[model samples]
Target: MRITELIDRTTLFDRILLVFLLFVTGASIVLIPLYLPHGGQIRIEVNNKLLYKLPINEDKTIPIGGLTVEIKAGKVRVADSDCPGKICVKQGWIDSGAIICLPNRVVITVEGTAAAPKGVDATT
Candidate 1:
């Protein structure tokens, strides 16, 4: 049957149920972020092994396995790396998510609430 015909067959109870579900979904989208935790620490790993856990608020530069990691102003990035392609270095500063240098076997990830920066959804 046509979509309009099916919609016309819906009862008042069905309409009410649909509205309730839409309301619940909208409420969830709005309220959930307010209740969730945000911003914490960053974890650095090498060769699948934990290397360092540092607070995101602190600013420092760390050298591990020929990669230079810099954490400043609540963000962390690979300032420099010996690996080719330099993909990790090009990633720049990030308040959330990770910088993975596969050639160097390094992984840096932001832990806790995975909130992205304002106006940014997900970084490449």
Candidate 2:
């Protein structure tokens, strides 16, 4: 019937287990950024202008527009942002693909290795 009544039906162990799970999930969400691996070369752009091209091996921080991009130990991520949602910061580390902050017009992408195609060998 009532919401409280339904909760009351649950045993104390069940409630404790639910609370434990919630705590674990929330903690994991907050700590995930610390464990993500960094990727290749990084290209950062802000407000439609090419800003910085950095090697992934270096550890540095760059302030671009309203966001702070952090590169460390061969990984890259938006460490801080002035935008409303901080969506870019939540993107964590990216080895490939792009992390875009629409509100601040900041874009970060991991550049892949470029290898020229070899000429075709003799074919019978």
Candidate 3:
């Protein structure tokens, strides 16, 4: 009887541990980006296609791989996704954000700041 009880507890412990690990991993993935500053202009390319170039002034949106991305306050995130899981969409807005859709061979990311590099004329 004691051996059976021990086995049952071990199984329960394993299940609990699995749940905890999953939660920790998921939280880390979401929270990690928030701490980093993502302010800047953005360049998105999908399958070598130039999707959009946006400045970090106000909210903006774009389409990549047939998906729509919404940006606000320097956060670049997928508002829609063609692929399953929708992890990219769930990732919310990211200021230096990136999402990969392997099926569509697409990648979206935020980059660049409002200020151009020294000696560089953006008007050119």
Best by TM-score, which number? 1
What lDDT is obtained when candidate 3 is compared to the true structure? 0.72
Clashing pairs in model 1, backbone N/Cα/C closer than 3 A: none
Q: Report residue 88 deviation for candidate 2 (angstroms).
A: 0.5
Name the 10 consecutive residues with the lowest summed lDDT in model 3: 108-117
The TM-scores, one per candidate, come to 0.60, 0.59, 0.56
| Model 1 TM-score (2 dp) | 0.60
Put down candidate 1 lDDT per residue, 22-104, tens digits, no spaces: 99999987886665444588889999999898888889999998899998988888999999899999999987667899999
> What Cα-based lDDT does every candidate model obtain?
0.86, 0.81, 0.72
**Ranking 1 against 2 by TM-score, winner:** 1
Clashes of each: 0, 1, 2
Weakest 10 consecutive residues, lDDT, candidate 2? Answer: 32-41
- Candidate 1 has its poorest 10 consecutive residues by lDDT at 113-122
lDDT of 2 by residue, 85-123 (tens): 988899898776679999998888777544235688567
Query: Can you write out model 3's per-residue Cα lDDT over 52-115, one digit (the tens) per residue?
Result: 7777667877666568877777677778877877777777766665777666666776665665
Query: In angstroms, how far off is 71's CA in candidate 2?
Result: 0.3
Error of 2 at 15 (Å): 36
